[model samples]
Target: MKRIIITCCLLLGVTLISFAQKRVLVEAESFKDIGGWVIDQQSFDVLYSSYLMAHGMGKPVEDARTTVDFSEGGKYHVWVRTKDWAPFPTGPGEFQLSINEKPLEDSFGVSGSADWDWYYGGQVDMKKGENTLVAEDLTGFNGRFDAIYFSTEEGDVPTNDNEALLAFRKEMLNLTENAKDVGQFDLVVVGGGMAGTCAAISGARMGLKVALIQNRPVLGGNNSSEIRVHLMGRVDQNHNAKLGRIVRELDNGDPGNGNPDADRYGDERKLQIVRAEPNISLHLNTHVYEVEMDGNTIKAVIGRDIATNQEYRFEGVYFSDCTGDGTLGYLAGAEYRMGRESRAETGESLAPEEPDDFTLGTSNLWASLEREEPSDFPETPWAIQFSEEYHIDDHKADWQWETGFGNFNTIYEAEEIRDHNLRAIFGNWSYLKNEMPEKYSHHELAWVAYIGGKRESRRLMGDHVLTQMDIQDGVMYPDGSVTATWTIDLHFPDAENSKYFEGEEFFAGTKHIKVQPYTIPYRCLYSRNIDNLYMAGRDISTTHVAFGSTRVMRTCGMMGEAVGYAAYVARKNNASPREVYTLHLNEFMDIIESPLSIHNLPTLPQD
Candidate 1:
């Protein structure tokens, strides 16, 4: 027994010596051409996948990529060290190190710091072997690594695991563990677009606690200064023609002329006026992540701040999907359809012969100003393909540059189409400015919009799907109505490519049909299956052709007002949205009528 004990002690000493010798010594010399090392073919694949995941709001790359492979498990001391001098901005400012996809906790007795003259770094994580390590750039700027080494010795690494470093990484995750619960509100509007803004303000005016969540810094979705699309609707002073009184009132009686040629004031200034309302709690730069539902009814909404990634929950009796994209409706399992409807199905003349027919294309608009100076613009190498044969000299635009006819099926792919159109816009602009004659030289590109204006997306399936026939026949539902002034205009898919600019005729077959300012049914606002949820904007129930007329922002804003008031009534009565649609139709109409009078506008047609 004594001999066996002595033999076991000797073997333990040998194992310790072997583990000590396995240390990885990364030094300054190992960092030569660091970019080449980190961005190799294998690393490129990893990076590409990481970007896709991040953009999709999926799991972090480190969680997906890190793997542990160990033949034996034991407590092995591990440390990472970078070169004293880095290729780029090195030290604490350039790189952030994380363990197990999380930053090392100070409670774990980790340490780190930036070296004064060289790169900054300190020791962290006295973790066991086979642990995953990740280095990220905390500074918005990219960093180039020089060298990194790992050693297994207590005093070998620089120790500086202070509270500040721990807090820095802790804040990145933005965990709400320490945040006090603020309870919930009565109504939560998931978008700050035109419809959403109206929904929150109108609901709040009804004395409900309303929370307005806007993903962007500003309100007014498409009409936002960021996108630059003008609000289009009728004014009430024209004898019930005022389709966008909500926005106009917010704009302080700023008249919105329906003509595209008119100088329409943007929606942001109006949004500011709405933001000052007492009952609305505006949460800007917050995006809705998910909707928590109880059966068919939504109980609460989960949102996240884009800057801090801190999550927030809002409990409410009712919710409105004014995101324009119908995000909330989609999340709540509401039935929706995208693309064109077959003419046979809707029994309308404008409907496509087949369901596969092209829908409206997105536009990447750029405003051009006539310049007097002899401007020297750089010629785009891709612009050589464009020639004068394509009517490049005819400066007038009737939506000719709108591309993406054959590419995507739904407007959700607007970004992809916008990228294609942006290339074309920039390429064409370069030729016009550089190659065109002096007579055409005055036109200079002024501004390109931040995002392309989307024409269509997941239209929520409502109790009544407004067909193209409804518009052509000027059918009025018994419930209520919102008026739109735009004609049933459809643009050809290949307008730019056709011999006559792809047979691209604006306001093609139908002239502006003067109907009696028909009312849109309340059934068309809320989703068919979802109990307490409502949808507004371009994504409401409508056939492809009907949408072309009703999808205008002015009509959308009216739809928002109607549905918003309905939601308030539903909350007050402790009833579902459908109940309000059926039993309290007059109350809904009264709300729309009363607000117009308060703004000193004419009453809408009751018939």
Candidate 2:
């Protein structure tokens, strides 16, 4: 056993120091068996790609294990990157570390720093051979596990700086910075959400070479299994009928917001639709972080594989910032807005009286399932305290469980906001389980979204910024292409809930100022400055008030279809997005009205 273990250790590149300390670095995402645990890439900038978060809803996920060969056999101190999520006395985010099927003396994941940092998990004897490391979740609560460092010396820990960590990761994993070239395409869509997915399909169906890059494994962004937001807003209504056939084809038929099943998002169906399109090159688990620019036009986009950390450069004639955060436009140095405008700035009533950094909050939807038997929940003293006086009575916490309004930038402070949401969910559930045990005896938390369903952020400026006046007055521009059907539904922190959890308002309230379905001008679909750049999704040109009505998934999907159609027109005319709006306006309108474009809806294969 010792001879085989030593040989295996040497063969696997396990570095060893004779008469010195040894270390074994195991990436959590590299676990051989991750069963129900999901990889979190939203914080790729901060946490890197090694982190894995457990979202068991209420049931604990199956243990995740990985085999590692020890360079030298001895007592090793283990450290894991985690946070003191729900920093109450007894944190709900609890997990146990196991080595070679034996539990570690120190129970880890119970206490960690506020940010991503290494927490000590006491020393253990490791045999000089192949051994298994397991991340055992004690509670289904959102316990995040990054990478585990089995070190001979405590001083050999990694720093929290992503750049430094990246250097360390490369050295540890033996990765190179040299990026591979992905073939050029006519159009490249940076996000795989409803907007990006629809944009890719819309362009592919038009016989254009389209490359769809998604940071996660799934196609639907917020609508994916990771986020679980229901498709809202009515499609195929009024002038927008032709624009939403793609969204309808991708719809999974679950109208409810917080369906427990991750499969409810129809991940496979969305993938199949994108796969069926020959012109569309689907790059899943690829995150586009940088853009190459030539004067004003984007030359290419650089991305990194989330799993392998391999870099890739995708070249394209045109690019779409369907990344609801306006990631591409921002990378291309295009003008954009992040928060609410001053009433004086837009001359709109809904605008804040003063210019402020207030934007609509993101949601963390969660639901409980009725179990056959009663379930016991652990005490989470580290979580936010909730009593019957401030408790919400419900089996599901839907879109209303929102946070990160006004206080933080959704793009920059994404991980923080997501952590806050997890704390809120775990904290609230702990309260319900402890205080109202009789009322919630049979209910078990089925699922809670870790990927936030963000409503507004980084609206890329376009030729024409749609305002409240445009929707209320029903002002139809000559370039009117997509019509938004949802009313002006603006979200605010619920006043009653705010009184208790100020600055951490998890409950949201919406004020719906109804308006007739109005047409959004085609000029709102592309960047105002970038020549070949196009945009869709919530990041389109719209005032904060106007976005209230247009930010729905279905509405954004239609906008994607419009952009896709425009991409085809631009390619055919050998014109830029700006030229398509300026010169080919009539041609664009004609294409939208054509039977080939409107009637041809991509459907799932009849099984």
Candidate 3:
């Protein structure tokens, strides 16, 4: 009987392998039509592809449909890689998987792990030719679906390991190893935020061929219409006045977040500026994930379109990692640090005597519009629970509605942080509309940011790490080109909110320490080990305590300007970033003082 059991197990394994050989996998992001759904790249590293996210708007969204070529006919088992969403018994975010216009017997997206896992969709009959697959969302309560698998054998399942999953995807899809060459440039800016947009524009104006790669469809990272973060901090300063003319051109004239319309963030104006530049090639919705490293220098960076899965390789002499998260620099093996430092390590008062994972959280800002009639919100049973004792009753949500501090690593656990914020937003909004309808009778949730605005993560180590001492004493380097005007505005979990939510506090408390407007040295902008890499934005070399002041968008934008000028000087003289700082500081300074070429500065309204 034991020998028979072993023989049967071997036969079953052989059958599973045979079935797996003929399986077909469809990447959700590569779907032909993704209506009312958006690509969620927060879990790209963990998941096979960027998944489709349905923002919690109550009503069911349009389905994502794609055509697939099947090699064999007959019944095939359908599997969807998704999550149960809330981890509770009642999962509000449930969706159905349909094939060839027929709905599957079992409902998908209602069960799985915190990370992605597969849910079986029963078996469906299919023709040998072309077939259509649809992700029909039942409730638009932020249900996510990564990819779908169809196999002739029920036992053939895809592995969850990153390498195995990636290899399976490539082999099944017959993807090419060589990435499609996009173009060559003097500089390739990885982000399209305030810093990256400024860097691209500045480089183009300085007569360098530039490639601006933005992960989103629009520019202005945190300040974009998608995220809708109001640009803060000062730009009109002593050393950085020349660095912000381009930033001024892109400002939407809007003062704060919670704007009714996304257009108030000025997506068009930013796009127009980048497009007007003859030398800058702007590739929006392209996410850079891989880097080609040659020794200590980077040769090319590879990116994929989030909409279509087409990969592109961008070659450049110099690279600017304005990706706030230090994405490119990290990919190229650049030294970096995350979280707080010990007092013994940095010797700063703000440094937590012992190191801790306590970085500022990302914000999923929201707002409401008041109407004459009562507005009804659907019950969010799967969302976080907020009682009368602990509920938020605000008409507008802004940067303060934050989470992820010490709860998780901001980069590795980004999806968890964003989902936690979403749960809080939906839960609180539901409470307002349902529990306290009298007070919120006329208020309707107008806009909730699907893309959370991130504050800090992965500061790339550079030749010089700016500290709070530098800001306090107004230390100036010969290569000091940008002035940081924001005070030491560090954030911690709100004590009041923590009492109710403990480790899951969404609101933030800021402690501001005033400091003189200090000049930021250029040495903090380039990687110490990576030769050709330059960094801007929040990821610039800085102690966690000092990042409080320099992490603001305007300060980061000026940092981008400095990076652009440095890139030009490095390329013109055939020198590295370090050489441009040490050997040719004066020539770089000349460029900083003589900028005003790219875009016309908008006139500020008099107070």
Candidate 4:
């Protein structure tokens, strides 16, 4: 009986192998008609060849959708082909084939045209019974698909020709190796905002080696003159802390010393102060691409300079992500949360009834004016989605024009949104200054920001997430405190889509709570999972409602000082941030109070 069963098993295995040898082939007759042959809309496109023909008139297109059905428990070969001869040439294009939306291992791209049929082939799995097949174009471009043919015969397994997989692996390996070579630093500050700048300066003033990495060309992230957003925070109204003092010293001369335009100096002065720090090495236009880890501790960080195409690897004992976007903390495997939390979770009356993914939107703001000149402005050709005909002009703001309506509001994809907003802004200005010479005849385009001002992104998960209740109750911690003074300001999600104000809605929830400055706990500063990583600015752990109050730049700067000094103390005593918060609380407070002690400036107000 055992012998008979073994023989039956061997025969069944051979029968399955025979069915696996089948192949299906698809071919495109011409590049022009390749559009209908694609299977996946998200991954494929026929615009690459069209773009080459259009003299670079269009952006790369990767749109294609085609589906196939098959029985389960089988294997089949799949391939795509182009006709022997065509008017337009074919280039590189990738196809990602999947079975029942569960991606199969076999997929490849066909490049290099031929006078004869050009074919690229791979294999796919067919589950038991009926199964759906799809081939998606990963790159939007022009390509051809000929036909699909299958065979049911036993044969050896075919080799894969997927270059994309190999290329991706190689890139990851290169990044890993590069990250391992970064040099060491006593302190590394990941963000270049007001807090980050102050942190670096404070650390350097204490004689600690510091490296300040800011993603933007300018130093001030949100309050930079580039964005032109005003600074806000808890300061002695009568004698404002020389928070802007370091900046003044770097502006060739102290502009605040008597210059009437000191406040207008804004970020330029801040940039100078950071750049002038003797112990700080500034890396502007550099992005922290990845973080290297050694068990629980961060080993080093790998960064790329966008302008110079240069890479940096810095090993630091303490790292602070002031990027405001929290890039470093995210890259370092820090725990984080996005969107709004439920009232059940945070125990705040203002918390959302349920969890939500809605976040504050970023803005591409322009400072425009009612012009007195009759000069004509250039006309815009793009589509205009807002108009007074829709009653959007009722609240139409010229100087504060924003573009957060139909796109993602976070800074992760800020450049794309900024472009879209600028086009509309310039287009509207042209109509006002040139087309409507009566009402806007006196109005002129004054200034447009270089980049969109981002509101939120990845918030690092800290030891304790700051809930709206914490802010309402004025919770204080013994570790450290960063005070915030902004009201709970929430913007409507579909403001741009609304006909009432052309879709812009600013809702001050319930009523504005005018509360005295409240302190943010130190636990809200560092990642819960990451041992050596800390974050400041708007990206720190806070409920959506609480963030409405804490996201201001002035408040973020104070957070920077707290974390920066904690980092300095950690380095001096070989301690982690938690240790400094717990054991060396006094020393930490001293540093914050005398951040400019090196410059002989007055101490900060004690807690």
| lDDT leader | 3
Candidate 1 has a TM-score of 0.66
Runs of candidate 4 exceeding 4 Å displacement: 1-182, 237-265, 369-373, 378-381, 390-412, 493-497, 500-511, 593-596, 599-607
Candidate 1 off by > 4 Å = 1-183, 237-243, 251-268, 370-373, 382-384, 394-400, 409-412, 440-443, 494-496, 499-516, 595-607
Best by TM-score: 3
Give the clashing residue pairs of candidate 2, or none.
86-382, 87-382, 88-381, 88-382, 89-381, 89-382, 193-221
Candidate 2 yields a Cα-based lDDT of 0.80
TM-scores for candidates 1 onward, in order: 0.66, 0.90, 0.94, 0.64
lDDT of 3 by residue, 240-259 (tens): 46778777787878658767
Worst 10 residues of 1 by lDDT: 1-10
lDDT of 2 by residue, 98-192 (tens): 88899877776666355667888788888877787888887777688778877778677778886667656665654544467888998999999
The residue-by-residue lDDT of candidate 4 on 1-607, one tens digit each, is: 0000000011111012223434332222112223434211101111111011110101223333334333335665543333211112333334554556766454444443432232434455666544444445543322334333333333422223223422321221122233223456788998787778877876777667789987666777656655556566554421224333333332332222112232563556676667677778888766666666887678877665432224577788888888776767766777777777888887878777898766766655554455455554544344243344532231133223444432454544453454445445544555555545666666554545435566766688888788777777776766546666777765544433443434433211224556556677878887778888878788888877888788876677767766766777777778788777778878876655555467653322222
lDDT of 3: 0.82
Candidate 3 TM-score over all chains jointly: 0.94
Ordered from best to worst TM-score, the candidate numbers read: 3, 2, 1, 4
True-structure Cα RMSD, model 4: 15.1
